[model samples]
Target: MSGEVRPRRADAQRNRERILEAAEAVLAREGTSASVRAVAGEAGVGLGTIYRHFPTQEALYQAVIVDRTRRLLAEADRPSPDPGTAFLTFLERIVVHAAQKKTAADLLAGSGVDPKAGTADVSRDMRQAIGRLLTAAQEAGAVRPDLRAPELLALLCGVCLAAERDEWSDELRRRALDVLFDGLRPRPLS
Candidate 1:
């Protein structure tokens, strides 16, 4: 056989997608105690099928995170009539994801998996995507001129980590995001 890996059959690919969706839901609800068997059951697939696709819980969680991040980045890259709204919406969506993804993230951290282990490329793409949104917002006078992508990313991570750590209520999360976004807005001067 050639060195190149063969593409999955359509059914296999479909099953993999279903497993990821179900895994996300199960992990979000079950926290660090979720099992591959539970994911297989949730996906309506056999244990062998899940093992064939993802040999370990770490592998499964990493794949789910990478899959979700890529989808979010795709949405962030789309054109929007209001760059400011798009940028803020992206940040908000990330915070919401943080809340849903806390269990998986904590599990990964506890497993000694470097947060960036399999996600370096996606992380770079995410930064670039955020930079593009920030630039557009700055040009539109929707955000302060002094802000950079790194600082924005830092702020975003802080709030996401806080939201996850504190288990903030939806109302509190929205209020916190409002405060953060408000700080990003440009200040009028005399």
Candidate 2:
């Protein structure tokens, strides 16, 4: 037989997608307490299948994160009439998603999964998209010129963490975003 491998069969592709979806749900629900067997059960697949695809918990988690990151990056890449508003909307979405997936977020934070490992390219693309948005906003004089993409990323993560509290509400998140976004605006000269 040739050394070249054939493409995955349609059934195999379906199984992999099912596994990823199940893993996402399980991880979101159980956090670090989740097991590969649990994911296999959720996916209605054999443990061997999960191993054949992921091999390790870290790899599975990385795949889920990369998928989510790709969706977020797509959102950030869309053209907007007002880049400042779009950026703020994107931050709000991050906060909402983080709140909804608090367990997953916590699990990833403590799981020793290197953020820059398998996600470097996607992360770089995300950063570049955000940088372009920030630049557009700054040029429009809607945002402070000193604001940077890295700082905004950090700030969004902080906001998301804060929004994960039990008492957190949409109003609270809106207020927090308002305060943070205000800080990104250019101050009026006296």
Candidate 3:
């Protein structure tokens, strides 16, 4: 056989997408405890197909992380008339997504993945994009001048953790976000 890799056929591509979707669901539900066989079952495909697409659990998990991160980054990159509103909207979306995928997010955070690694480029880009948004909001006087991007990111992570509780509803999340947003707003003279 030639050493060159051939492009996937349409059916093969479909199978691969299915496997990825299934893997994302399994990971979100089961975290690192999810198995390849379980994902194959969820995808309605054989184990061989999953192995062909993703040879290892780490590869599959990384693919899911990359896919989600790209989506979040894309949302952050979109332009808005009001940079402050845009940043807050992006934060809400991230919190909701993170809450829904808490298990998978936790695994990725705890996995000791190196930030300087090639696979972490998207994560780095996300941080930069968020930084730009925060700066824009600060310049507009929409957020506190003292606030930093890293602090906002850490705050969002904390909100996501709070959102993971079984009793946490969308209304509660909104209220929590509102409180957080209030803290970010510029304070008036006493």
Q: Which ten residues in a row have the lowest lDDT in candidate 2?
A: 103-112
Worst 10 residues of 3 by lDDT: 103-112
User: What TM-score, computed on C-alpha atoms, does each candidate reach?
Assistant: 0.75, 0.78, 0.83
Write model 3 residue lDDT over 14-80, tens digit each, in one string: 9999998998888777665788889999999998888888868778877887778787778887788
Clashing residue pairs, candidate 2?
Answer: none
lDDT of 1 by residue, 1-190 (tens): 5798989999999999999999998867765468888998999999989888987777897787778778877899789999999989988887787787763233212223345466655666676777899999889889999987666777787777677677779999988888989889987783
Pairs that collide in candidate 3 are none
Candidate 1 accuracy as lDDT: 0.78
For candidate 2, the clash count comes to: 0
Instruction: List ranges where model 1 is wrong by over 4 Å.
Output: 1-18, 30-49, 103-116
Across 53-149, the per-residue lDDT of candidate 2 in tens digits comes to 8868778877887788677778987889988788777666767777665532332232233565776566566557667877888888889888876
Segments of candidate 3 deviating more than 4 angstroms: 1-4, 9-11, 103-119, 164-167
Q: Over all chains combined, what TM-score does candidate 2 have?
A: 0.78
- The residue ranges of model 2 lying beyond 4 angstroms of the native Cα positions read 1-4, 7-11, 31-33, 102-116, 164-168
